[model samples]
Target: MRQYSIADLESRLAPSPRMPVLFVGHGNPMHAISDNAFTREWSRIGADLPEAQAIVVISAHWLTPGSTHITDAPRNRVIYDFGGFPDALSRVPYPSEGDPVVARAIRQQFLDYEAQLDAQWGLDHGTWSVLVHLAPEPTVPVLQISLDYAMPLPELHATFARLRALRDRGVLFIGSGNIVHALGRARWEPHAQAWDWAVEFDRVTGDALRERRVDQLLDPFRTWDTARIAVPTDDHYRPMVAAMSLLDPDEDLSFFNEQIDMGSIGMRSFMTA
Candidate 1:
């Protein structure tokens, strides 16, 4: 396949430096409390971040149909969305405030559509698992937007691009999901050998991101057989599109924890500078 380069994005970068978008590949929920390299990197990144107005996250765990919504609660209750995990994982706390200001701004931005204000919704495992390490004592207000695959392909990409502007305003946009996540085929061992298909899909994903090839990403399965196995369902993959949409061609992209955790899940992550 033909490749695009940073020169392509550099030409498209805005005059002002945009806020960095961090795409975190949050694999096992156990990492939330563990002091692994992934969590350590999260801690380092959090310390280096610019002061932000509010945080906006797109998590694989949050799914809704037809409409998109953002959390609007004052203090969100951590949602133990996963099953069969140890009871200790559920007891973890992430008592962060929700920003009504950013929530209203998002509603106004998508003014044409009635974006729902969700009070019942709160931080899911996708968000908290990483946030526990990224921002242990996050004083910054946080909000989450549900992923709606029902939107037309064109509209889905366009909306994500709109949110990219939030970076200039000091609003952090985080996408928390793995590059390759096939739970049914995962190896429970930390050092288990990665499946060949998982490794292939993960490499393609990183190459596509560095080149800003959204077309290949949106329809990854066309070329790579591993794509189908990697993304049997796209709940974990779509957030990547939304997160990478805002990245300018010229800005630097850095990746950390560039390895697969389980045999089936690639825990590769990147940030757009």
Candidate 2:
């Protein structure tokens, strides 16, 4: 892949417009290519939203420390980062353009933050899975801001605060991750079962978010009762923390596809006004 500097790519794209915020519970990568209830909810959510100028997705799958990467290439590739999936899954493609101008603008928001321009980082399953359903045309200019896994709660919240300004510029911000993700517990059960730990954690996290308990929501791994089981790993849940931070306390929040998947995973998604 040809690489371009941050400055080189920023000159190619246009500025963004004001857009809404979304916290999607992007389950298994299989959902990306398959048509199911979760995919239907994603489609509905996209239909309900106003047109957006650009989209910035904070995916649970893309985690880095200190610096965030922005893609400046003309055509971004679909990254099949997962294994043990069917060949059909690997063939699914979402051909979205990269917006370097928006990427630079986002980098400017973080005063002390380092934003790198990379052509290598493509759309991971966390991003393409939901986006395939949300923006099927793939015409929208898209950029991904990496999540710094090493950063503490306070720093993460501060970073998201900078991103809140993008909402007014018509850049749809989406955090893709499940609220309750325990891969070991996922089964082929017909109805969603709320494991004792999963239920408690999801409920508490929901309450904390609704009540505007920023601190608790920021660091669920340590504060929540079922932190260990609910999260287990920071891969999926971390993006929600970033999305939740961008939310307005007074905005009306709604959950989509609210249910338990398998036995433990929480497939609940949220939209904030």
Candidate 3:
């Protein structure tokens, strides 16, 4: 990938046009309430993003084994999917409205997979945790599409690629998950040095993303040796793949929060340029 200066990247983007897709490495739930480097950056990014008609999030936290689902409620309730966190974290309410119309449109695009309109599950920490800082106002309608755990990586990527048309209709698509989320290998301490394998996997993944080599990332579990540790489960890494699938052939990508945290989790994030 060519190294594009900020000016070069900005010049390529259209003036106040379609929304850019975002792949956010939402590392810790605590970042939802804390005033940290990651949260501050999220806020800054949100401020810069153009207004959208609706927001669609593909979150790592929501997984359906056999099918895809999209939230279609009029309003969303925050789900505290993680325990042992502060009470304030659970109390943080996004109060974002749901777009049933947009949800139906998403389902129409995924009809081959028998996509369902879901009203049971609400926004999990993978969403509100980041949006609490990103779109703090919660005025725009928000919807979440679940990951089909049984689907192959390539198939999932192909399926998501079809949704790129939504961007033209003023939908802000966000794929929220960490690149290397090996919780079992994590050192739960501040300033913990990242593991060598974690760093290596992150570097290679970033290289693939920068070069727009989505095939390498689609099967990282077998393609990259370090993925055995860096991607113990596909849950976290799949969202990034879904995000990249939405990239336009002519679109460039810019990365931020390019660091590994807690010895194993990679906080590298990227967006369309």
| Leading candidate by lDDT | 3
lDDT for 73 in candidate 1 is 80
Off by over 4 Å in 1: 1-17, 152-154
Per-residue lDDT of 22-136 in model 2, one digit per residue for the tens?
8888888888877899998898878778877688888888888766676665578888989998999999979888865676677776767776767789888889989989988
lDDT for every model? 0.81, 0.79, 0.87
lDDT of 3 by residue, 1-273 (tens): 233354542332224467899999999899999997888999999999988878889999999998888998878988999999888888987888896666767776664767888988999999999998889996678999999999999999998988887787678899999999999999988899999999999999999999878778888977899999889888998899889888897899999999887898899999987
In model 2, which residue pairs have backbone atoms overlapping below 3 Å? 17-169, 17-170, 18-169, 18-170, 19-170
Measured against the true structure, the TM-scores of the candidates, in listed sequence, are 0.90, 0.90, 0.93
Poorly placed runs, candidate 2 (over 4 Å):
1-18, 189-192
Give the per-residue lDDT digits (tens) of candidate 1, residues 63-119.
Answer: 887988999787888999878988898899999998655676666566577788888
Tell me how many clashing residue pairs each candidate has. 4, 5, 0
Candidate 3 wrong stretches, greater than 4 Å: 1-16
